[model samples]
Target: MFCSTELAARLEGVDTELIIAGSAAAAARRPGGDGFTIPIAGGVAAFAEEGSPLDKVAGLGFAGVPEPAELDAIEARYAERKTPVQVELAHLADPALAELFTGRGYRLVNFENVLGRTLHDDPATVRPAGIEIRPSDDSEFDLWIDIAAEGFANPDTQGVASHEEFPRDILANAMRDITAAAGVQRFLALRDGETAGCASMRISRGVAQLTGATTRPAHRRHGIQSALLATRLGLAKAAGCDIAVITTQPGSKSQQNAQRSGFDLLYTRAILVKD
Candidate 1:
């Protein structure tokens, strides 16, 4: 399928909006609730904490290129906090945006691919034997967080690109904050009466964002991930979302799973960092 710029605009807009909203949610839940979001450079500059994944800029350059002063102000926000400024610029965004970052000393750090597929009618839900996928209840919040964190800790290295790794504690905290974001839904995959996998979905503006999914090291290759994906798509369609999107490291197992499930390569985002 042809990937159009308009489609990129819509998908990236939703993703970035959620990033901002998720950061705001994390800020409010903290002790002092100290966090901020700034609308700059035709996108958003958000900070949840010193090393938060959310402390970055996104959906940039869709509007006219910002003046150098505007870019300087964005850097100042992070400079005051003594943290690097990171930008996730979509390949389809205004080319000048990339040039501006390079000219300002932002070096390429990483890349992530945004994949998507249209949701129409009902999804063909996959029911793998010995596995059950169901909504995570409030009482199981911590359990879900632990399972997700553990999965990330033992990541699958069967991909072309390398992925960043974080401490297990930090991963747990990030999962908690993101799952608490507005409209976010959690799912737990059970096998043999034990939790085996966890996933999340967030719906906004007719888009269903497959926020994350991971299976425990001991439970890998039990069709847990596939089941989780199919279940979320079905629910997202029921909720009236026309599009479902997922971001993954290029050629990772996650991306391969998404591709097998009908998602197309919508666009790639270049992560540029200024330290």
Candidate 2:
């Protein structure tokens, strides 16, 4: 059910491997993403892009890597790129089947090391910084986009802001409409009256998504990101969210911050390229 770019983005610059949904594979490489695509197996396939010809898990065989002919079949049907991709075998997948993956030079990057926690029980603590937190309004869209571009990453790049544009930018901007109508808050942190960082969250249906936290290069070591995060946690608790779900890089400064702020690591999803 996962998209290839989604997996690739999470893995980031590691370049180990990427798994993908066939739909995303069909979309030509996204300039700032994994650059490869894979296909989904079931219901969520509806969400996958149309016209992908990749096979489902069953047809591909949960037993092991497919036979040479079968693998050739997947390659024939999967036409978005020339790169090879791997099918992730879940923990429950038969061991014999998993060996096929191992035999084919595909290594399982165990993601269990990543963790998550519920925010409902977290106690907020005040931390000191010369940061001022305020709401992000439509008028500040440029600042918002700039901050996102500055904080988010682009595949195959160095330095945070040195990244390129991302596909999620379009999707995220669309969701802002829903949050805007509900008075869900998006906050910006400023150092000495200039924007230093930004974070946004929405408490809805008892779920608080700690989304979009960023710190400008000049603002690092100043506690701007942490303050914004703590503020978000307080907001979630005040609004009565039962849990917060954050899916960031398995290990990054942002991911560590989330874990430290009472967030727990959930199992990870991956994207892998076989060849």
> Which predicted model would earn the best TM-score?
1
User: How many backbone clashes are present in model 2?
Assistant: 21
Full-model lDDT for every candidate:
0.85, 0.49
Clashes of each: 0, 21
Residue range 53-110, candidate 1, lDDT tens digits: 7788988767778889988887988898888888899999999888888999999988
Model 1 TM-score relative to the real fold: 0.94
Cα displacement (angstroms), candidate 1, residue 136, comes to 0.6
RMSD each, Å: 1.7, 9.3
Tell me how far the alpha carbon of residue 21 in candidate 1 is from the true structure, in angstroms, after superposition. 1.5
Off by over 4 Å in 1: 31-34, 161-163
**How displaced is residue 195 in candidate 2, in Å?**
0.2
